[model samples]
Target: MSVATLHYIHDPLCGWCYAAQPLVSAMQAQLGDRLALRLHGGGLFGEPRRVDAALAQHIVHSDERIAQLSGQPFGEAYKQGLLADEGTVLYSLPPIAAVLAAESLDAAKAYPMLAAIQNAHYQRGLRVVEPQVLTELAEEIGLDGTHFAQALARADGHTLFEHVQASRRLLDEAGGHGFPTLLLEVDGRRTLLPHHHYYGRPDAFVQMLAGQLPAVH
Candidate 1:
């Protein structure tokens, strides 16, 4: 019996990463027990170095393109509510920290919480920068709110910083193009999978892996 590892490199605040969620979910379902699906946080955004009309316009345009390609929903609330609201820059540290905090408590909750956070931001236009909002989300997902809050309180500490660094290292090792990168590894050797497999037909993703690796029986 052979086992393959699929590493999904993503960031919670990445629009493209959110767009790839369905594809990743399908991959998880189709692969079943044939492979290990590992989630890695790729650092994509930072404190608002420069966010203005040009950046906002580019974001909307890119989001539209992603929607067209992936058939993923980018709600009007996200556009009109979050994007229209000013004083909100492209900050990612808090969301990533929340993911790390969840992972610390329960590894299984991390990726699911990532999906929930993405939905909360992309659909509901809820604030991801606020610890309070993230805590509420944690509670909604059955995570211990007090524990999540304590971990988030230590967001600026070494633990979260180490998670960020580890993600960056994995991303670089995979030679990822951007967020939502996928890599396959078997017997200690790694191979980068094309992003197109995740676009609209995730079934094709399953077929592609089946052709290259052991089939899930």
Candidate 2:
């Protein structure tokens, strides 16, 4: 039997994407060798701009809603510490490009590195815009901090742009109109898993995938 591929289309800096991380991780753990996971960068912000006050409140409220609905933890620090810092730029491209750089260095480390960045930004309230924070994360995950930094500094601008473009194309093709979408391929066919809203229990999502998949070696 051919190995199944699960493509996770998401933006690294998206709050809802952060909420979905635990479930994705759980799915990955369960599938293991039976599946291959791929990350597609969904650029939520193509252009940099200051987050408006209303927009910030909306984001925080959405996070709260997800936590309440899915039972995911959304601590006060996530909003107060991370989003409250005015100096921190809310650019999604840098971190997305950074993950691509990490993937180029080591594919296995890409997802974990991305998850770490999200945890730092959303959970731990670390400033992702700061080079020092990213560097520290790179080192923590046993990646070459210098190379990671260099790659991020000189990331293929056009390539990253193209990646976002491609992801948008794929999203359109899949009829997906949201962030944190999951596209699964099995037996040469693609299916978009329905995730109407955020989910709190990662295990439930994992079980959903396991149930959908045929029992085969």
Candidate 3:
């Protein structure tokens, strides 16, 4: 019998991805070895885009909306401390590269590392651009900080570009052009997983997955 795989493609800086984390975790726990999970880094920001006044306000409002809908916490500090700094650049490649590096070392650690980066950004208001911050997150996820840092530094230029290219290819192939999209592949067939509306219960997501993919064993 062939095993089924779940490919969760998302961007690290995406709010909806943050909201879906718990639901993915629940599905993984229930599905166990019947499911093989893979993380694809969907690059949300390709270049260093300046956060203009309008964009900043939009981000602040989007963060609030995500918090309200997903029950994910967003503190005033995240808005005031991080977003208030006008020069804050939004380039997610570095952090996304860090996740890919961690996955190379140990696949199971990807989600935890992703969560650590998110918490550092949205919860603690830390700038994820700094290498020190990424290294600290690596340590927190049981990865060799030095190795992870070296991998990130080496891959900072070309490897990340390649990963983003792969992500783009996947997105194009799947005909998906949205953040927080979930694609599950079973028996060589790929299908989109249904997502609950922005603020719906995570359990609703679990039920949807359960109905779509039953246990193989």
Among the numbered candidates, top TM-score falls to 3
**Model 2: worst 10 consecutive residues (lDDT sum):** 195-204
Give the winner by TM-score: 2 or 3. 3
Candidate 3 similarity to native, TM-score: 0.91
lDDT per residue as tens, model 2, 77-165: 76886567555567778778878878878888889889988878877777665667877888888898999888777655888889888
In order, candidate lDDTs are 0.80, 0.78, 0.78
What TM-score against the true fold does each predicted structure earn? 0.90, 0.91, 0.91
Writing each residue's lDDT as its tens digit, candidate 3 over 1-217 gives: 2277777778888888877777777767777466777778878987777777888899888887788777888766778877888887777888898888788778788878888888888888888777888999999889998899887787678888888888777877887757777787877898977664624476677666667675655
Residue 176 C-alpha lDDT in model 2: 87
Task: Provide the lowest-lDDT 10-residue window in model 3.
Answer: 194-203
The TM-score that candidate 2 achieves is: 0.91
Q: Give residue 142's lDDT in candidate 1 (0 to 100).
A: 90
Winner on TM-score between 1 and 2 is 2
lDDT measured at residue 191 in model 3 versus the true structure, 0 to 100: 90
Q: Please give the distance, in angstroms, between residue 72's alpha carbon in candidate 1 and its true position after superposition.
A: 0.5
Off by over 4 Å in 3: 198-200
